[model samples]
Structures are given as structure tokens and as C-alpha cells.
Target chain A: MANGSGEVVRNRQVIFRDYVSGSPEETDMEVRESALELRVPEGSNGVLVRNLYLSCDPYMRIRMRKLDVPSYRESFQPGSPIIGYGVARVLESGHPNFKKGDLIWGITGWEEYSLITEPETCFKIEHIDVPLSYYTGLLGMPGMTAYVGFFKVCSPKKGETVFISAASGAVGQLVGQFAKLVGCYVVGSAGSKEKVDLLKNKFGFDDAFNYKEELDLDATLKRYFPEGIDIYFENVGGKMLDAVLLNMKLRGRIAACGMISQYNLEQPEGICNLMNLILKQVRMEGFVVSDYYHLYLKFLETVLPQIKEGKIVYVEDIAKGLENGPAALVGLFSGHNVGKQVIMVSRE
Target chain B: MANGSGEVVRNRQVIFRDYVSGSPEETDMEVRESALELRVPEGSNGVLVRNLYLSCDPYMRIRMRKLDVPSYRESFQPGSPIIGYGVARVLESGHPNFKKGDLIWGITGWEEYSLITEPETCFKIEHIDVPLSYYTGLLGMPGMTAYVGFFKVCSPKKGETVFISAASGAVGQLVGQFAKLVGCYVVGSAGSKEKVDLLKNKFGFDDAFNYKEELDLDATLKRYFPEGIDIYFENVGGKMLDAVLLNMKLRGRIAACGMISQYNLEQPEGICNLMNLILKQVRMEGFVVSDYYHLYLKFLETVLPQIKEGKIVYVEDIAKGLENGPAALVGLFSGHNVGKQVIMVSRE
Candidate 1:
């Protein structure tokens, strides 16, 4: 036993194993226990923080493979901590802007405590009215993503026909609500009946369907959008995108946020009805939410008021403990979670 | 022989054989000759005019099929004359604006003469400074197609990387020049070396390639646009479009004017790399140039100055007589003509 000398630390860290191919296994990551001195180095500009909650996003799957082109984010190095956006509390601060016990949200390591440098992108949480754990989900990157991707990129107009694929996911839920708020006829596709009900009842969508039960997506879209779809927020590609192409209206707009279906395939399926885009005079656009970060202040001004007025409802699937993080992340591929997936590292 | 007063009409018209499949043969069209009155019936507000020059466009191939959704223009009737944009004189006019001896350009019959009503879309031609047949190619629907497709649809910027497929065709030639006129770095792909040279030397493209020589279209586009394409004026779709999708820059725009490569295809080839659009943030829009005819005065405002100052150059391969019209019209698919193919039917 050792007496506390104003430095309390236990270095139990989640370390990545060798790079994975196919489906990821729990054995691919290891949690090792070791000793740590959780004191900030003298004259260091960085902050030492204790990670409270970790976000598990589908894009993290792309980071596992080496890419020829520089993708949205760099691939994770083997045998290193897999970093992502998370909520944390500052244990020790060497920077003037932040102090010990200050709550913040930013890029953090997959461990009990992390030394974070680039504090410019970080935000100190002032309005802690809601659950602090929300920083890992609805109030964080996913919310910003849904906002920017729909409003800015899609350029939605009132009374337009809007369709969203993977409607029960984190980004899709917000997009559907945003579309409804804009006075659009919103229809969404989900994997199960529960998710479909969540979209129609909770999200206030005009119509929702389970794609797993539908034999033909094209016929289903025709039933919903009799005139034709004016906007499509594409989260799942492959056959869904091909079907959407055929149903798009004249001067239609598509915001391609993600392609979850095509990510793990060795050879993705070919899209056949793209020629319909030409025939119908449609506009299809793709974008990343991080690129529009400068619009965050304006977005917050718009979203925060709605949140406070109880206009925008959000849900999260929180997996307790660091040990469950790996499984929670992998579950995203199978559409296991109902909403945003977050792993709670600690209650504080 | 027929005089100006004599009612002499011999209608020999090409008829569309019952909904063709596979590569369309000249045999698929049958010329049937019948006796007809040349004059519009009494009390009818219709103009009877002799057909001069008929225009052949790739979009005609799409009208040959029976689509689930009706196209912008109706499909040709089985035993009727193949209706197309043509140059003709008002031999007899029942409309107030048009009269006998006036030269006009609009949709007309493919045979010797036609009696047409609802001439609202037609316009009387003035200022015959150049060859009258030029109205059939350089100054008529094709010109409007090139102008509106490039400027309005593409939204070209100076020094931007622009690529055009089928660069030597009627519309593509002017699209290349329009891009060059806007100070863009223009590259074009053609079927043969002669057409490629014409695109570079005559139309003033920055680079021109014979696509027949380049086995890999993707590599060819990469070689031309190492930084990625800013705008792609898609004329021939299929493999060319698939390759261009992979080489598009962030926020890149594609104006889908035509898809000649897939016109005759029974089951058109599918594209696999469209998922790249999400990563690159691209915009692909399809348009019909006719929809933007309200901008004709604006188009003339820009084009007239270019022609007057010799800033624009036009090329045409003229067939000497009306008898050569059949051969000249069929020459499009074989890449037989150098530039805009025109036929001289008569002289005023």
C-alpha cells in the first residue's frame, strides 16, 4: 500500500491489438492494468483529463483500414489506443483557459485518463442543464452532423418530399425531425418494426417502413412518394441508393451522409438506376459534417432553442462500463442499438 | 415538276418499327410514300411549310422505347413521320406573327413539307449574316443545348478543371469552347484521333484524348485531372461516368446532358464507385436544355458578342443535297462527320 501524495492514478487502458480484417472480435482489443502518475507536466500547455463517456460511430470502422487517399480521418495505428470524440472532466490543467474540475468535450484517448493537446477544438461545458452524457451523442458531433447535412447541404424547401434511409440511427433521427420541422413530408426506412414505430411516433415522421420486411424498395418508395421524392438523405448505399435514384423528382436533391451498407463488403454492389438522375433532372450532393464546423455557433443558436422548447427529442443507447465499448461499437453494423451508441466509462 | 401555285405533295416519311430492341438498324425505319395536300385546311390556325433540314439528337434513342414514366417529349408514333427540330420556310401561315416568305425554325415533319399548329415555341429568324443552314446546327437547338447546359447547369468558374465526353459532337464541341471562353482548363474525349485534334486545335480545348486508344478511362481521367475534376459535362455515360465519379473534386458539379453510350444498350452497364461521391462531396445534376429557353435572349446577349468579335468559331460538315440526309443522319453513330452535320435542303 502507498499513501496518496496528491497524485492519484490507475493506468488501466484499452489497447488495440493487430489490425482486423472482416468482423472485429473482442480479442482484437485488450485492457491492461498498470500504474500511472496523473500529474500534469510542469509548463505543459495540455490538459490531463478523465474520460467519462466514449462515442462509438460507424465511421470508426473505416479508420481500421489503410486508405490510398487521405480519408475523412486517418486510420488507427495498430497496438495503439483508438481515439474518438468523448465527454471528460479536467483532472489537471496546464493551460490558462481551463482549470481542474472543469467539464469539457473533445478528442480523448480510450483509457481512464488522457493527456489532450489541441484544445482549440474543445468546448468547456457551461450549460449543464441536460445530462452531461449527451455530449457523447445528440448534443455533440452527431447532432451537428444531422443539422449541417440536412439544412446546409440538402437545402430543403417547405412541402418537399423527404426520405431517409437507416432512419433509427443517430444521424437519421435528427434529420427526420429537422425535415418535419421544415414542413416537409418525411418518410423513413428502418431495419425493424420497433425502429419504424420510433420514427413515426417519436420522431413525428409522416410515414416509416421496415426495409427488412419490404420485398421491393422501389415499389415502397413509389407508394410513399406518389409524385416523387424531392430530397433523399442517404445513410445507407447499395440497393437502397439504386432504388431511390428511380423515385427522385425533377430537380431532386440527395445529401449522401454515409454508406453503411457498402463499408464492409469486399466488392460493393453496382447502382443500376443512376440514369434516372439524368432523366428526372436531380441533384445529388455528398458532404462531411466536420467541414462545416465553422457554422457551429449558428447551428447551436438554432438547435439549442428547439431543445429547450421541447421541440427536438433525442434518444441514446448507453452501454455501461469500458469493457462493453468494443461490442457496442461493433453492434452498429447490425443495427442493434436503437439510437446513438455511447459507452459510459464512469458516472462522474 | 411543281410550281409555286400548284398543290404538289409526295409524302415519303420514315416510320418507327414496333419498339425496337438491341442496336437499331436502318431497316428498322421504313420510308412510305403517299399523296397529300400541301396546304393547311381552311379555318385552321396552322402553317404548312416545306421541311429543309432535320436535326438528329442522341435523346431520340430514348424516345424509341416504351418507358414506365413518360419522357420530356412523347415517343414517336408507329407509322408517323419522325418529328425533330428542323429549319423551314412558312410556305403558308395561319398564325399572325408568321407569314409566307418568312424563314423560321421549329419542330417539323421529316418529309418534304408539314402542316403544323401551335407555333408558340417557334420563332422567326432575322439577320441572315451567315449560312441559313447554320440555323439547323450552330444557331438552333444544338446551340441552345451547348449554351444552357454549360453556363446555367454547370455554373463554370474560371481556371476550373472541366471535362467533356463525345467532344466532337454538335453540342459537345460548343460546350468545350464555352468552357474555354470562361477561362477554364478544358479536356475532351473523342472516338478518333481526327476528332481529338479538332477538339484541341479548332475548338481550343486544353487537352484532347482519343478514348479508343486509352484502354483505362479512369487512368485517362486521372492523368488529365490529377487534382480531380471540378466540372464534368456528361454527354456519353456508362464507363465514362463511372470513371469521372472517382476523379471528382469536393463540391464538383456534373451536368448530365446525355448518355449516348447507354442509348442502344439492352441492359446498360452499372456504376460501382458512386460511394466516392459521399467522400468527395460531389454534385451530379441532370437537365434538359429546352427547359431553360426563357434564357434565350440572355444566351444571345452572350453569344452574339462572341460571334461579332470573332471570339467564337463554328465548324460544320454540310451534306450538299436533301438526298444525302439519310446517310448524313446515320453517320452520327459511326463518327463519320467531323463537326455539326447539316444538310442543305433548299435555298431562298
Candidate 2:
């Protein structure tokens, strides 16, 4: 698989077709072959890397729309290769921090290779004791998202009741385990029974419920959290949010990590019970993980040990090739993926 | 005019007729005469007071319904005398904190005379330098609500942009003044052109708008706050809240004081733009002023001087007697009152 230095190579890329309005489909993106030089362009401080594992995240769905307002990320260009977080092996570098053959993880392309102009945003993969694929889910952005959301944002105290929506997803799974580590009671809601089982049996949630089967979400929440929720890690929004508002305890905190449920709709479902926020004296805060990247090293220190000791676990649903990337990403909207959805682009 | 140490008197009362749905009407309550004893019951720690000024607040509308969940205030009991905040003169007291001839402000009946069993909750009026009617608006519950909500909940900084809804109402008026005092640029929205004029010209708000005239609230907010709102004192909810969510600046804070717009509706309006809270990394919190009563003395220390120096002013829409109490309270739902609506039950 080794190519001569500076040799021209064929790169397979997933290209976004156009701006999306409703639920994104596999046809919205296409896998195509493009030519690339296996070198950083002369006089440019860019790092050329061959992407390995690409992360299929819900937030990417937001970037598919033509955002009329300010957002943390720009909308994906219609004809360009889709940009996302991925594990990559640096092929050539003109940057000070990165070198050829160095393994890294950060914002890369959904293609086999990418020319990253801002390589400084990339983290050098220092601890490969865990599988490199973990960098795309457990040990990378999602893990850091869980750490910041649960510990910094929600500030859960011992014995507090915690609830996570999309519980078997990458970030929610980690949040549940972190709550357990803090000695808080944790319950989770997912779209399927298998995911529910994984939350309770594998991730150590105190209880789990299949939200798709529940006719009344407020009643379902009451059944799971009889004492009321002290912390809610919001991933799926809309009706789930409205229902959770009714069941929040006094001074409860909701960390708005993502709203996967509403991203694909032309009109996001209306949340009707925000009055409960005032009645219960609650705080709901929204945050971006990039704001807390300065604490990434600190996060790894706290989480890495737990993973090694088997105190924390991550479940990933891996698609075996770059060709399957679009389906894996689109599956998120339909709750078709059982866990953390990842595209395995290459072995090295 | 003085009765002997103890005597029976005719007490005119505003009685809640039944649980109300939709817009509360004057017919929901009735003016009636009932007998009252001027003395506290034997060995009872109660204070019998002559109600003078009864505060008519928007939150009272919520109490007209049958509340099935927990709330800061109890539902108005059907067939019972309506309860509310008022300025009163103590006629008798078995409680050590109060005595006969003392002036107090707290929860009292919508009647000429009330026997307050929970006299401890009442604040004894210390300085009569200002008008006694001020206690019902500027120096009592609504005043404390504005203080805690602005200084404590919003944590507004100098030069920040503040926007308040229901701006000429009891609490919003004070919040706007407090924000201006903090060196912040403040804009307010009210229902009537007269109220809007009071906000800008009378209350010294930087700008004000008549919300009723603005068909597109979001566009109106954008016009008023071109730089985006940093702190929003949320007094009216529903469409206004949804619009504010879209116009909030980065890391903005929204203090949910009350939602007068949704109180009388059978189904509260759905908020569709809460996703902006995430996109902007915003914090929206709901609070009840009762939680901050420990800081009342501190609040008075800060506000009383402003009143004395003519740095702050108050406006009241005083209804003549207990007979007008129902209409005064009902007026809040229709935006009929100009400022703080207070019913003068008795001059003495």
C-alpha cells in the first residue's frame, strides 16, 4: 500500500450534492474518485493526510442546510468533499507540529486523503494503547463532548437523578457512564429495544426505556424518573425536550449538546412546555465542544483511566468502507444505527 | 371612626367564583360583603390587617386555573376570597414581628380586612417617606422580582444590550430602569403606544416599541437590537420568546420572570427556535423571586435611595375600591392597565 514520495494517487471521496431541506438521504452525497498529489503543496504550511476512520455525527446534518444565521460550523459546499472529524495518517507535512507518517485525529475530509490547511486544529495521536478507531468516537470529540457536557455544564452532584436521550449514541453513552462514576442515578431513552438493553446492561444505566414505544413521553419520563430529573443531557430535542421540561426537578440543569431529532425537519417540532423551566427554576444551557478544547488533555486524563479499568465503555456501529459512508451518516436521522456510527475508510 | 378594642365590621370582598379557562373575565370573581372581626383569634399568632392597596399581577391569571402540578403560588380556591399581595395596616397581631398600628406589605386577601395567619411573611413598612402605594409596585414583590431577576439571574454587565418584554408592566419597568442604571443599553417592548412612550421618555429606556404594531416580532427585535440582545428579561412568552431566541447574542442570558401571554391560553404556544440557544451558546434560566428573599434588605438598600433621589420613579393604575378589584385583575390579561394595576380597597 506504500506509494513513492510525491507520487500522484487516486483518492476516493464522498461529495455533498446539494443543500438539504428535509431528512438527508444516501443520494444527497456521492462517492467519486479524484486525483491527488501525495505531498503538501510547495510554500504552503498544510499537512497532507490519508484519512482512516471518519466519524458520522448528527451535528453534520446541521451543516447540510443553508444556514441563514450564525453557527459554529459553516454549511458544506455543494460540490466539495464533505469535511468532518476523522482519524488520519499524515503523508506529508509542511507544518512545525506535524510530520510525515504521524497519526492524527481532528477535522478532516470524508475522502481517502485530505490537504488540511489548518493542521494546528489536529491532535497528534499520543496514546494508541486503545484502538486508533477509538479516536473517531470514544477518545476524541464525542468523548470530550460528554466530559464537558456532564461535568462542566450539568455539574451533577452525588445522588442526583440523570437522564440521557439517544443513550446508546457516542456522547450519551459516555455521559451515562460519567454520571454513574459521580454516584448519580442514571436513566436513558433510546429508539430501539436493543439500544435500551445496551444502555442498561452494557453502559450501566440504572434504567432505560424505548422512547419509540412510549405513546406519552411525559408519562414515560415519570416512570423512569419518579423523583424527577436533576440533570438532562439533551441530544434528541422536540417532543422529548417538551416532555423532559415537565419532569425536571427544581434547579435542574439541561446541557444542550445536540438536537438530532429536529435537524432534518423543514420546521422543527415546537417545544410547548418551556413554562416548566420557570415553574421549577431550572437552567438550560447550550454549548459547543470546540469552546472547551483547551481542556482536552485534562479530559483524556480523566477518561483514559476509566476506559483502561473497564469502568467506562463505548459501543460503535462501524461501516466497513468509504463507499458506505453516506448510508451510515444518513442512518443517524432514522435511528438505524444501533450505536456510535463510524465509517472505516482505511486500515492504515 | 374608631371602633372599640374589638368589633365586628362589614368586609367587602372579591370572591373567586370558579376555576377559569381561557382569558379570565371580571365575571370569574364577584364583589360581596362579609362580616369580619377586628381582633385576632384567641391565642392565635395572627395579624388582622385593613387591606389598603391590592396589587393586580399577571401571574394571578395562572391561579384562576386548577393547577395539577407544583408552582410557586397556589390556585385561587373557588368560592373563597381571592388572595394577593397588598399594602395593609395592622389592626391586631399575636405575632411578635408585628403589632397593632404597624404598616406591612405581603400576601393579603382581596377584601377590606384580612386575618393573616402567616404574618411572618409580611414585611413591616419601615420608611413612610415614599407613598404607601409604592409598596404594592416599586418596593414589594414586583420590585424584589425585578431586583433579583436583573442583578442576580441575568448578571448583566456594563454596556450589555438588554431587552425586556411587557416593559411597562410592574416588573419589566423596574428591570429596564435597573439595566439602564448598570450602564447597559436597554430597549423595551410594550403593548400600547402610551406604554411605549412611558418606556422611552418616562422610564429612560434607550428605545421602545409597541409590540402589537409589529407583525413580525423577530424582524422588530432585529430592528431594535441590531447588535443582538445580550440579556432578555422574559416577561411575556410564546411568540416573543421564540423571536428572542433567534436574536440573542453569543453567550446571551434570558431571565424567565413570567409568561403573561401563555397564562390564559388553554394550550401554551410552541417555541420553535430554541436551537438558537445551542448555536449561540446561550443560557436561559427560570426563577421565582421568593428564592431570593434573603437578599431583600440588600435590595432595599440599593433601591430605596434611587427612589429618594428621584433617580427612579414608579407609575400606578389605581382602581378605586374592592368593587373594582376583579376588573383590575382581569385587565392584566388584556393589556388594559398602563402600569402597575393596584386596587385601593380602603383609604385608612
Candidate 3:
């Protein structure tokens, strides 16, 4: 029962093969074409949107594994299209909030088109002056994650020392910039020398290091932060976390944003230094960005100006098409992407 | 340094033999008799106190080891008298805040007599209506630890579910009682059936389990808290912490008061389920009671009344004489003590 204007169209989608055990491979996802009606079903409050860009985040790996316990985000169905944060343009809507052509970003399918049953989860893009792809990272979910984790969770004080793991990534890069803006001494750790250079020169971090080159992370951290770190924006966990735990100052705050290093393992690495949390009186708090969406408008009000004025800079690694989505997503586990990894689904 | 009233006395002391590596033994400490001048030296701020009841706490295990990093407490000096929290009667005082005949509880040597140079660290016993031995457990540091950790750190709401590890210990018992006072459903885990019984019957905990009897802690936790735990009073770390992480509800709080299980280990157990913190959006905060000592008066105001009215109860495992102090202290690591382990130095 489709309208003449709402014809069935071929949708290119990335489907999750099965529940992953260890490190995810490109084979875990299959790019397949499926037919989808270009309209929300009658009497349903769903919004049909044309997905433009999809994010490749560390947290996605957690979703790939079979979860025994309840989690914030649901596991992606094996046969269904991979779901993630993406920038999309509304094609049709049965909801009162929209009619057509509204730019939005939130939880969407890693496909050409998505029928978002929960339209309320998608946020309408207000500032189109910025790149549309920014909604997949810098101006969207990851951006809010950085803002909430650093500002609210870490509660950074000016002149405090901050260390960030996976500092070249989407959330970490933004946290580094935010820390700098607040007059904090920021140090970042990345896998590659290029990312380290970007952290120091482009992201305005006080210091940066290639974690791969460092033999002892604890010693390296001691060298970077002689007095000990005040805030640790944790993205990479395992050894980095253990090392950071050793180097944290008294009353230190660790915002547990993501633990990428432990996500792909059969068994997560043992965190031996958590006892330091007591000795240092540290508060390690974990947060999901969805919980802070109430502060979204406030976040936008604060960050939009900084982005426009060049006070904050965001680097992105954009893959050209949905067919390349599997490789791009898999590459994230290997630290293959230089910055915010995004799959460019469609230009229009 | 001779005084008309002051006289030399034979002081029986427990001396720390050396820096310990793994599980501390009674041999790690030596009982020796030393001569002490029962007076505060002329023009000095030190207060000479006759030690009465010495506290045998798990944190003493951490101090037993040689620490490479800066910690809240310094390492126990080898070949010196073992230092810990104890009740004492001041026989001589040069400090303005303290005077002769004043009863105090704080950092004191595990000996018959101790000359405390830092008198400010000690709290003068205002309400001696309670047992003097209570100062080492129910009315002193461990009590304050339970108060700050449960009320301030956990931020528990009424009708919430709470789970405490090492529930029969000094801090855990009080925390359980406090949780019950706050109108929360409380569950606790101890090593023995007797301690578990004490938690349920004496402490008014809603449920209790012997962790040693439970093969799968996660399953046991699921059984106890069908709805996930809201607050976790973390007294024991390692496998318990990993298990607790899995059972925590959304936005759950874990007050990392102490980690008795991990303290004596050469290498602390690797925590595998810390990722659950992010997934559940939980907060695991480590706090030392010293940070909240400003509220000691307020804590006394709250807890003293409860103790008097029989709303709260304290269970203590008293080891008689300074000679038995080492066994009492070392027993903590093995879960041998049924409750708050204390050493009675002298009745006076």
C-alpha cells in the first residue's frame, strides 16, 4: 500500500554476520542490497531517512559481542543492518514533529535508508553551517560524549593536568581541546606518530606521545606529567588504565568514556592498579552520552561558537562509501583511522 | 629530659620485621619489650599516651609493603614499632589541643605506650559513655569510614538495593546498618556462615551470603538482587569487584572504602568486568575516611544515638594482649576474623 511518490527502492546495508568472540574481522559484516519502501508505514510514528554518514566508534565493538548482561545500547541483530550514530536526511515521516527534508543525527542504520521506529531518538540538526558529516562525530553523539565526560564527569579545574588515552580519536580529540580551553595542561597518547603530532600541533594539547613507542607506560606518564595526572579521559583501557592509575594525583578524576583495548579480547585484561583509586582518592565514573542528551542544547550553545571561531578543531577520517563500511569499522579495532572514523554513505 | 612525675617504664611493642611481599605472616612482626620515658619532652608538642586498645585493620597490610608511588599512608617503617589506629590515655601532653588525663583515638603505635608527635591527627574522646574499645571499631576511624562511604559516597536513596562485600568487617557491618537505616534493601557477603548470620540477624541486612560457599558470585548476586544493586560498599576487591560490576544497576555507586582481598597480594587480581561500569553508567569512587574527618563530629552526632537506641550494632573480634596483635592483624588477609579485629593492649 505505497503511494506513487513512495516507491520501493534498493537499500545497500551492512549486516552483522553473528555475535563476535574476539577481535572483529571484516568478514563479521556483509554488505548486502535489500528493498525498502521510501515511506514510514501507515499509522506508525516512524521516520524514513536517507543515511548520509555512519560513525565507527570503539563502543561499536562491544555491540558486536553477545551480551549476557543488560547494557545501555542493545546488541546489533545478526541478520539486520548494523545500527549506530549517523547523519541522515528525512525522506518521509509519519510523526507530527517532521514532514520532510529535516537533517538529523542519532541512532540510525548503517545503510542507504533507515526506517527509524523511534523517531524521538533522532535529533534534528540546527546548525547546518558546519559540515553535515560533523553530526556523525564532532557536533553529534561523540561530541556530546566528550562534553559530558570531560566537563560534567571529570569536573576539570583550570590549571589541572589532564591525560587522555586514544587522544586522536573522536571523543578524545574534543576532550583535549576542551581541557585546553579551560586552561588545563593536556597530554594525549595515540598509537601513531602522526596522531601524536596532530594532538600537539593541531589539537592544542600541551604534550603528546606515541603509546606504541613507549616501553613502560607508567614511566612515560611520569615523564609527561611529573606531578601526576589530575584528570584521565579513558578511551583505551587495560595497560594504559593500569599505568594511568599509577600516575594519578590525589583526588584525581577518571572519566571512563570507552575501553577500546579490552573490547576485542576473549577475556579483558586484568586492571591491577585499581587499588590506586583508594590511595589517591580517585573517582572513576563511567557515562553513556544518551544519559546527557538533556544537556544537548546547552552543549551545542557552548561548543558551536568554539567550532566556528576555530578555538576547537576536529579531524575526521571519512571512508567514501557504505561498501567500504566493514573495513572501516574493523580498522577501528586496529587503530587504522587517524581521527573520527566515518563511512560516507551518500552525498545527497 | 628528666621530670619529677615522669618515670621510665617497660613498653611491650610489636615491631614490623621488614617490608612484606605477599601474604604477611605473624613472623613479619616481632614482639619486643622497650623502655619508654612516660613524658612529652620539654618544649615539644608531642603527647605521650598509654595505648589501651589497638585496631587491627586491613589497610595495615598495604603499609606493610614497600610502596614505590606516593600514597595516602606511608609505608610501615621496618625495624620500627608497628603503627595503627588505637585508643589511648594521654599521660603527658605539650600540645594545646590535648592535655594529661585526656582519652584519644587515632594513629598510635602498636605498643604499651606511644608518644604521638602529631597530636592533631588524634581525636579526643568526647563521649566516653560508649565502650573505650568501641573507639577502635564502632566509634572511630572504621565507623567514620562506614558513615562517609555509605551516606556521602554511595548517595543511596530510600527503597534502593545495596550490596556490601566483606560485610562482617569493621566498616562493612556499619555500612550495612547505615543502608538499612536509610530504608534501602541491603544484602551482604562474608567469608563464613557466622558472619553472614551476623549481617542478617544483628545488622538487620535484608539478605546475606557466605561468598566462600557461593561458587559463582555473579549468579549469587543475581539471586540476592533480582533487580540490580544500587550501591556497593566495596570492602573486598579482586573477583568480588568484578562480580559486583556485573550486578550493578544503571547509575549504581560503588564506594571503594577498602580492598582487603587485594592488599596482601603481590599482584592484585585483574578486574575483568570493569567495562560493566560504562555499560551500566555506574560510578566507582575510592575514598579515604581522613578526607571526610571534618564531618567526624557530624558523624558522631548521627551514629552515637543509633548505637544507644539499639538501631545499630557492632561486632568485634578482640585479641587479648599486645603479643597477639600480629596474629590479629595478619588474620584479616585470610578472612579468619569474624568481625572487627582489635588487640587489647591494657585495660587501663
Which candidate ranks first by DockQ, i.e. highest? 3
Which DockQ value does candidate 1 get? 0.67
Better of 1 and 2 by lDDT: 2
Model 2 ranges with Cα > 4 A deviation: A1-5, B1-5
What is candidate 2's lDDT per residue for A108-133, written digit by digit as tens? 99999999999999999999899898
Error of 2 at B204 (Å): 1.1
* Residue ranges of candidate 1 with Cα displaced over 4 Å: A1-8, A12-28, A32-45, A93-99, B1-8, B42-44, B319-331
Worst 10 residues of 3 chain A by lDDT: A1-10
As for lDDT, the candidate ahead, 2 or 3, is 2
Q: Model 1 misses residue A339 by how many Å? A: 1.1
Clashes of each: 0, 0, 0
- Per-model DockQ: 0.67, 0.82, 0.88
Across residues B200-276, which tens digit of lDDT does each residue of candidate 1 receive? 89889999999889989999998999998999999888889999988888778888888888878887788888877
Positional deviation of residue A150's Cα in model 1 after best superposition, in angstroms: 1.9
Q: After superposition, how far is residue A231 of candidate 1 from its true place, in Å?
A: 1.1
Error of 3 at B238 (Å): 1.1
lDDT of candidate 1 over A29-135, digit per residue (tens): 77776666786766567888899999988877777766667656787877877788899999878777888899988788788888887666777877688788777
Candidate 1 vs. truth: CA RMSD? 3.6
